[model samples]
Target chain A: MAAVNFDKVVKSFGAFTAVHGLDLAIDEGEFVSLLGPSGCGKTTTLRMLAGLEFPTSGEISIGDRVVNDLAPGERDIAMVFQSYALYPHMTVAQNIAYPLKKRGVPKSERGAMVQKTAELLQLTELLSRKPRQLSGGQQQRVALGRALVRDPKVFLLDEPLSNLDAKLRGYMRVELVELHRRLGRTMVYVTHDQLEAMTMSDRIAVMEGGRLQQFAPPTEVYRAPANRFVAGFIGTPAMNLIDGEIRQSGGTWQFHAPGLTLDCPPLLDSARPGPACLGIRPEGVVFGSGPIEGVVQVVEQTGHENIVVARIGADMRLTGRVGAERVWQAGETVRCGIDIDRAHIFAAGAAGERLNRPGLRPVEAPAVIKAAR
Target chain B: MIRRVAFNLFAWGIVLAVAFPLFWMLVTSVKPQFELFRRPPTFLPETWTLEHYIRLIQDTPFLTYFKNSIILSTATTLVVVAISTLGAYSLVRFKYRGRESLAFLVLFTYLLPSVVLIIPLYLMLVSMGLSNTIFSLVIAYTTFALPYALWLLRSFMAGIPEDLESAALVDGASRMGAFVDVILPQLLPGIISTALFTFILSWNEYLYALVLVNSDSARPLTTGVMNMLVSSFNIEWSLLMAASVMMSVPLIIVFAFLQSYLTRGFGAGGVKG
Candidate 1:
């Protein structure tokens, strides 16, 4: 097992930056995920850590040693690619045995190791069969088994489960977690799917536009995202942002959007109101019994759950999650409430920069200069 | 239907045009000596004879020429195939400064026509005392064959995903190990077709063979036939045709056996998407 560290690493293809000044520390035996949307540099960062791609600047280290110049094999890291690029000419047994054979392991030891891995992956019966003969899931297991047999310092997976169907992806996600737990190896997985990141990772590093947005435990990231982008990316319905003045209405603070307003969370009142964006998660947008009102625009039914998309005003929409039993319909004006304790106030001048509660502010956000008096 | 029938007739006319010389040669080989001068050609001989084939084999150094052709062509094919495949793989897989330029240079070797380079090559060979040797012919054949082989195999290798080898590399393979295990096996059919082409090319080549060779020792069958028919102006047309018949037989048989690789031949020009 190894601790992988990337120190201010930057990767560029010519002038176009692919991964920008990424610094991360993945601890031994930890399953961390690099999560983001496509083209967000998650794969490039994983490749750098795997030594398949070189950094344009800065350094990377695996365990105690600096592995910046190490070839992929020398770094002792194994990667399972999305395509499950098995050697087509080789049988399952040979494919799994490739690493050992390359290491010049003796024939008897190679046979033993391949047999053990194949059995662990439940590929014993398919040992002599070629990759084409195996089902997709079986080929995936072989690709994974090929990595496991190496007993590498770290396991790097570049969207390994993305190629599988949804149900199989879920199954393999659990299997992968179990495998990591059993072996206790450092594993860094990359995926654009937020659900995969939330379910599989010990820590999730969320990225956007080639830069790190937040790196924290998955729950923390989902609960207290560092910026607007992280806030919107980690959740299912995506957090709602209604842009308007944070005005004092009848001496009780309220979050305001055009043609609509809400009772503001008490925690936000200490700071003077200004042009701010009120952020609330769809789950926090309650179904009934508060001042906020909207004409129901659309109701999406997903079995036991309901997603209500409503139009509160011209050019503004709000989404609320309710039980499927609820009858919120289009053109019906529905009363709802915001869980004020969970509401967030971001400065418009800062443009979605978080108002980091109490006496402090984010270091990047300077002293308040433009708040409405 | 009318256009289809017209197309069929046109195609058959072209085929008959191409096969007419071979058909005439075959009939003349078996016809009696006097039948060759018939006012109108004898489509079928009144009396067939083995007399021309027997005389041709016994009177000429046919066996020596046959052996020379096989040795030079087979050796050239093996040498060219072996070297070009490795060279093509490196050019395709490895990225380095000047790689594209180097590939252009390999292609440029083909642009140097044999006729223009023959005098210098012959002078060099004579100085090295290799002018009439089979080894020299192998070297000459490589000059013509290497570029095509390299171009063909390089394109074939390029069609294979680099991700395949990267997967192997991460699976604990060295770069060379990945090439041998993952990429080379997929290239097998391409290499075989390349070898077959080079072999046929070297087997039929007569330009360099004629220029450098002064004796029967290094003469391949094509030159040996020409030398015999020309020197003996009162040539036995039947015997000459019989020799041509024998020379073409091996190639036909070889092609018959390896015809499945026409699909594999497509692997060379190539498996380009």
Candidate 2:
């Protein structure tokens, strides 16, 4: 295993830029995920590291060696494509043994290595079958076996679980995490699924529009996002953000919108008194009596919890997560309270900088925010 | 039940219509030469004889022509298929300044009629002193066969997913190594079909063989068999029929072996499945 680094890497296709000066460092044996939506350059970043693509500028290094000029095979990296690109022409044994054969492993040694890989993946009984004969999950295992048999310096998986059914995806998610722990290889997984990144990554590098939005631990990304984009994109129900203006009234700051007003959290020392946005997680929007009053719009019941969306005025809607037992009907008037301690404040506009929390990293937090804003 | 039976009858009628000539050729090759002038031609020969086949093999220079045809067709198929397979792969996969235009140019060459090209090709071969040789026919046949094979294989090459090559590259195979290991296997059916086509084209090509070679030693079956009908004082119908039946044997054998792959090759180029 080796540590991987993307030193101010940028990738562009003619007039369009796909990844914009990305600088990420991953430690050896750490499970890092590049997470974003489609066209967000997460896969491009992974491919650059795997040597499938060359960065337009900057350098990519694996284990302290600059690999900008190296081919994928020369980089000693193995990748599992999203399609689980197992060779349809070869049986499971040959598919797993392909890398070893390419590397000039002797025939006898290749047999044992393939046998051991199949055993590790619980594919011993199916080693003689062609790829078409295997089910989706079984083909996935064979793809993994092909990568694992090489014991390469790094393992790059590009949305490997996206093709499986729901239950199989969950199972493979856990299996991947367990496999990462067992092998302790430096694995860079590219995925657009937030749940997979949240559960499996040691540190999640959230990206959008070809730029890295936030790179921190999953809990850190969830609890204190670097910007408004992270705050809106990381959660399932999505954090409720209301555009308003904050002003210093007397000694404290108050946020004022069209029909609702709330005192700013006292912890926000850097909360500039100007136009800003307030972000509240669904769980933080309490449904008890308080200054804010609204009519319930919709309530989505998901077995153990209820997601209640309430309209505060002519336009603004706040969603709150509450226990399933105590539910509010649609069109019912309800008094709602904003959990001030858990609220997030941001400078208002398209690219909002977080006004509440201090920036996490000087390199990632300030320059990108300044440039984008 | 009546509709099904009627459909079956119509299908069988069309099949028989196409197959009757081949059946008559086989039957005529074994019929006695005197049976040809019977008042009403027999559907099944009243007297079967192998004299035509024996005489064609022993008395005529049929074996020499057969060897020449085999060499020419096999050589043309091998050379054309090999080059076109690599050319189509490069056209489909690699990026270069003129790649797309070059592929279009290859199809453009295929669009040109063979009769329009034969004169210039004959002059080029004569100037090179390659006339009256099987090698000359192989080179002349490649003019039409190469472009046809490349065009057919290009679509087949495009049907293979790009991810498979990327997977092979990441699995420690070089670009060319990955092509040989991954792509060649996937392209086998396409190669077989293209080879079969090139072989048949070279085998049945009468105009080029007639113009390029006049010696009995270098003559292919298409022109060589026609020579027997026209050059003789009286046309030997039975011997010519025997030669026609012999000329189709290689094609029949090729079809029998690669019949499944032929359908698959056509299907793969059209739809993904």
Docking class of 1: acceptable
DockQ of each: 0.39, 0.50
Candidate of highest lDDT: 2
What stretches of model 1 exceed 4 Å from their correct place? A243-257, A260-276, A288-293, A346-353, A358-373, B1-57, B97-140, B208-215, B231-236, B261-273
Q: What TM-scores do the predictions have?
A: 0.84, 0.93
Model 2: native contacts recovered, as a fraction: 0.61
Once fitted onto the true fold, the runs of candidate 2 whose alpha carbons sit more than 4 angstroms away are A248-251, A266-274, A358-373, B261-273
Pairs with backbone N, CA or C atoms under 3 Å apart (clashes), candidate 1: none
In candidate 2, the residue pairs with backbone N, CA or C atoms under 3 Å apart (3 or more residues apart, or in different chains) clash, namely: none
Candidate 1 chain A: 10-residue stretch with minimal lDDT: A364-373
